[model samples]
Target: MRRSRTGRRAGAALALTALTVPLTVAFSTTASATAASSCYAVRGPYQKQAEKFLGLRVDGRQSASDCRAIRAFQTSHGITPNIGYAGPVTWGVMRVVAQQQAAGHQPNRAHKCPTDRGRIACVDLTRQISWVQDGSKLVYGPVPVRTGRNGYETRTGAKRIYWRHLHHVSTLYHVAMPYSQFFDGGQAFHSISGSVWSAPGSHGCVNMRGKDAKKYWSLLKNGDDVYVYGRKPGT
Candidate 1:
């Protein structure tokens, strides 16, 4: 017998509810606890990139101190295998962070997203950030987000928040998508039970941090304008 989508969602919701702390925090704590005693001495493919990102010496070599710092960052950011390897995923996340820093206080300095529409949610796929703006006033965010992966790139252009389900569950994926606000077709702004920086990106949905998603839920409503622009790095 096959399980129903509703049943699966119900199960996932129950499981999600059992968690005491935020998923990211819980994962970070767990990963830190289980991390290896000594950092891996092997040099990753992007060792120098990761080193520079972490403000360490760019020697292109993985030192013990470098490994510990990188591991700490990996654990905090919910990157898997937190083994201190400065691999592609680690460097990718670092690059996103750099862009985010550069975009601070003026996420729309480029004026890519149309500001004509009042109270619009702007998504910069290139920087992997999202912010809510009311005409010229910045209301919320400029928060980090994970967009769609290669084949499932998030569709760009203007849209509207058509529906919102507070305790939403993905019927197809059978996972808890808390605080979902759908703006474009199946693609919505939702909170996942993991780091927004997790690699390979989402399956078209714009994934947000728990706090950010909840804020979006409160600030946005049906009929609100949504504008998505730029291209994700890998896609």
Candidate 2:
């Protein structure tokens, strides 16, 4: 009877151990999955500035799409290990670039832009701003812009707007180039999202705000002078 009691106790202990081990493993697995699914969220003061720059809603909330956009921008600008998180490095780059643009300093002091000034679109690459002038008189802008990145620099010097498309889509990149006015080969001035101001750059085009782009489309016609001067900052 004593032996049987001992045996029964051992069997119960074994069964309990078997059940507890699986339960512990299961709990650990669940905890790991939850942690993995949770992504880092962007917030604080820089969030507003980043949103404005990226052309996203100025709301201070960071969404999944925001992370994705941030990742895309990081990838384009050659930020390593594009993990889609807006950490210190990302925010620092944006602040520096924005400050440079706000300074409105031109790189080409000697280039007087002495061509057909009757109606011209002048792009100051250093300032990252565009303006429409009618014979030295400013018609529109000093508006913010995003030019091409390092490798695909926007061609500097004199050019002419050869084509105009109100609703143009790029065949190469397949992205929309709204209110596009092609000045250089496969390069144009068009409207892009505010997010564009964040980082990376257009392929070879001058990206303007949506409102500014529409204004340019209305103000300038095809075959107008498009003078691009200065080097884009950090290029």
Candidate 3:
């Protein structure tokens, strides 16, 4: 009876092992695909996000301003548009991204900024902004910025110098662009629109004093990593 019971126990264990093996393989395979898809999304985009990057109505008509807005944003981020920078890859991602707030998702490994070694430079661009000190170093820059309309929210993230215009110009603010260095998402480190002590302003780009902006502009280049944190310029 004891020998029979031992054989039955061994058979039950073997059956359980058979069921688990496929599950483990499936899970790992799925994880690998998800990672691959994410990289392709950021590097290329699908169709939906492309529209948002272009600032167009995903299914609606594309206006002249939409074209201009998209151009300006990309320029600030230091990206020379792709043929037109209007790739289908970007559009698909934007379509999936809701303008309204959703459950928070963490940054994928791709977005982390390099500090010191990885970062040859840093700046906090906002219209009428202030500087942050990490030790004796001025780790944060006082950036003048423009912000979104009623519901648009400026973002904070691991950033890098996307594009650097040695001597650039701006049309919206009716003056030469300050700092003129673009960071993530078409935002830049530039001069503030006006003189002020404190206010919540900007459509979500950094602002600066023309002279100070020029100083900041002199220090950066494309791909030098940094982080853009806190509010849009002056909070």
Candidate 4:
């Protein structure tokens, strides 16, 4: 009777293990599924602003969907560490985009850029935008630009393009400054391979996208008027 009782207890233990194994497997599967769907959840400071810009439901909460959307925008715009956080840098670029869209045909509606100058390149440091205007006529752009940083701010006031180099390399920094059109002392309008949206801006040059720079090269020549105005943010 003692041996039979012991065998029954062992069988009961095995039965319990059999039930526990399926539950453990089920929990592991659920955990894997959750992990697969999980995304960075830290709420960014500019969460609401970024959400609104992306046309997402703006509750200011960070969700997996929001993370994916923000990450995609960052990746496309060349914003670094594209982890989906809606930080200031991200929102800053979005603000530029919004301004660009709103600019429409009247980029100079504010009349900050002098219209009297014929075929002038207008650089608005405040908006971080650049365009070419011929006596109130929009000749080209109003595109986003990256100007000089805080200390090495792009000099303001009216100037003239003094020189041009099709394939210029900076002697000071040794970086490529393509389509360089020198307007001020050591400061020029050039194309950078990197994103114009990247912060802290250029050393002194007015950085532009490849296409925009190329267009400027075609339209502008030496002695053309170049007017820079306003103050860059944080400068």
lDDT tens digits, residues 75-179, model 2?
A: 665554455566666775666566555645442234455434688888877767777777656677667788998999999988999999999999999888899
lDDT of 4 at 69: 95
| Over 4 Å off, model 2 | 1-111
Expressed as tens digits, the lDDT of each residue in 1-235 for candidate 3 is: 3568889899999998998999999999999776533311122333334455454567433344444454444344333332223444234223322221121221212222333443343333232233333323444343333343234444566666788765567666555654567776666666654632223345555555566666666665677555654343223
TM-score of each: 0.83, 0.58, 0.38, 0.82
Reference-based lDDT, each prediction: 0.92, 0.76, 0.47, 0.91
Model 3: per-residue Cα lDDT at residue 69: 50
**Model 1 alpha-carbon drift over 4 Å, by segment:** 1-35
User: In model 1, what is the error at residue 49, expressed in angstroms?
Assistant: 1.7
| TM-score for candidate 4, residues paired by index | 0.82
lDDT, candidate 2, residue 153? 95
Q: Write the per-residue lDDT of candidate 1 for residues 140-192, one digit (tens) a residue.
A: 97999999999999999999999999998899999999999999889999998
Judged by lDDT against the true structure, how good is candidate 4?
0.91
The 10-residue segment of model 1 with minimum total lDDT is: 32-41
Q: What would the per-residue lDDT of candidate 4 be over residues 47-147, giving only the tens digit for each residue?
A: 99999999999999999999999988888888876878899888988887787778887889989999997999999898889999999999998888999
Candidate 4 local Cα displacement, residue 58, angstroms = 0.9
lDDT of candidate 3?
Answer: 0.47
lDDT winner between 2 and 3, please give it. 2
